[model samples]
Target: MWTPNVNTFFQIFLKNFKTRKTDDFSATRNSLCVTIEAVRKFTTKRRKTSVLSKKSKAIGFIIMSAFGFAMMAAFIRLAGDLPFTQKTFFRNLVAVAVAAVVLCREKVGFKWEKGNLPLLIIRATCGTLGIFCNYYAIDHLVLADANILNKMSPFFAIIFSLILLKERASVFQYAAVLAAFGSSMLIIKPGFSSATFPAIIGLLGGMGAGAAYTCVRALSRKGEKSARIVFFFSMFSTLVCVPFMITDYHPMTWGQFFCLIGAGASAALGQFGVTLAYANAPAKEISVFDYTQVIFSAVLGFFLFGQLPDGWSVLGYLLICGISVAVFFYNRNLERKGQ
Candidate 1:
């Protein structure tokens, strides 16, 4: 199983979920898509496994991860009127099926250490709630808005880590976190706004994401491998969601089915790419690169859905991005000074 960074996973998953609406495709496109995805699984595995320069591979992985996630969001949007339960089912089902094959091929054990089982369960549970909140936020808010709120996970992660893991928080980190929260409020603009409720919901979703990611980080420190962590969580997410699947099941058209499949395939590719990217280099070096997802999402929102960020929202985006970049550089400077 993979020792995964669930943030990269959700950042791609939930942000895009709120963006594109999917279209009904012709039979030809559906068939072609299935065929392409079958090939893609093989390609994704080889691509991740192949030898390459670390930075080059990490950058390549991050780019592909963003693109794959963008595609997943488009498919989710295209799924049209499907029950969220059903959609979640298909999204996670496809991801697990593909990721399972990768884990087996990589010779990674799926068995958990009895001692670490609790951590795995906690991580999976948090991850599942994160997904649920992500969908809710996506359904309720504008795509761009939903995504911006979801990205607040990083800020929340710091807090969660400080509280739950008893990790030390730097003064600089606290300041950046405050800036991020302030920026989020600019996007929320709560007074006299109908969006206020969902904005709050979106913030909770971000909290869920942060908690989930912090759990994964703790799990990572327990000497768990990435695939192992991911495999267990994916399986857990699929199984726990079964009741929702049974109770809220909706019949899907072939187009919807294929779109979900495509979404899964894209997520699978992203899962592999992101896992590889961070594995290859220190996160400080490559983590900022993933922020390109915001740009990709902005472009996607505009072209695909005719949506764009408002001026203050754009300023909010800039604030969050600026603080994140600053935090990265500041952390890097600290590391250099310490060295």
Candidate 2:
């Protein structure tokens, strides 16, 4: 007769329950209790192994998401030789068209309530600014450097969360901000063509993005439909880009056009993937995987642009990632305490 440990028994029982029947919270709770008991009994090494496994899974998802975003960066850089506004115009056009086709096919029309329009507009404006700044940075900076700098978003998000959302940040979040700023300075050292304007744009874009996300969180509370929000973004951005599309636009080569398509499609897919990630996993768990963007950007930059970040830059990457990891765990700990 084999006597299984609580955790082992819990795993088997949960697996069987998931396979056999409907998802009942009572059953899940019982299984979870068993698993917790087993966890309590586990040796330190076993517990460490379990923690590592969970981290690995979370890292995998984040890495995938970050890679998708990096691909968007590469494509944007390739398309940036065109007029900035024109690039924006076509990209938004493609995205809007794609979204419209999907909505029509699915018969998922959005009903716009008057009260929600302001929130929707605000979200769209923030997204548009972020995309615009990112594209402009791609045009001006080395691809890897731009990506590394853009990773500052999470850091900025921390501050914005404090100011706009009135949420207190952990010490780890402050450390992450310092690390990101340090990394950015390494990339754009002083007296390097005054990258100040572009950097400011990037930073503001990041802050705006955080505010947009906060609004999304708020809307989610009120049961606002994400599809409606997305629809507003698609429609509004396309409308805004119309003047840019008409003036000073040049014909693009097939290659250039294809690159724009790639950027647009990746943005659409990445948007959906990121939404799902935040929904399924804790932000702390998902955010750490964002570090993979540096790796992806480095690889893509070297292969496509013949640009490589220096040792200082690489070290900076590590520092930024380290801080971000610390922040994630800190937030996770806070969440555990129900704060």
Q: What tens digits encode model 1's per-residue C-alpha lDDT throughout 1-339?
A: 222355544444444444435534554455445545545564554444442344556667766876777777788898887766677777778878877887799887777655889988887787677767777778877765777677676667666776877766666666766676677666556443377887787778778766766676676666777677767777888898899888888888899899888887876776556556545543334444455565566666789889777898688778867876686567556544542
- lDDT for every model? 0.68, 0.63
Candidate 2 residue lDDT tens string, 1-339: 124476676675666567635578877776667656655555444655555455455445556667777787688778747876677666666667766776678777777655777777887898777777766766775544455556666655555555755656546555555665666566445343467787676666666655665555455445565555556776787788788777767898888899988877776655544543433343433454565566677778889999888887688677767766676666556554545
Question: Top lDDT: which candidate number?
Answer: 1
lDDT of 1: 0.68
Q: Which 10 successive residues of model 2 have the least lDDT summed?
A: 276-285
Q: Which sections of candidate 1 miss by over 4 Å?
A: 1-70, 142-145, 177-201, 269-291, 308-325
Please give the clash total of every predicted structure, in order: 12, 0
Clashes of 1: 12
Task: Kindly report which residue stretches of model 2 are placed more than 4 angstroms away from their true locations once superposed.
Answer: 1-65, 97-108, 112-114, 140-152, 180-192, 195-202, 276-291, 320-339
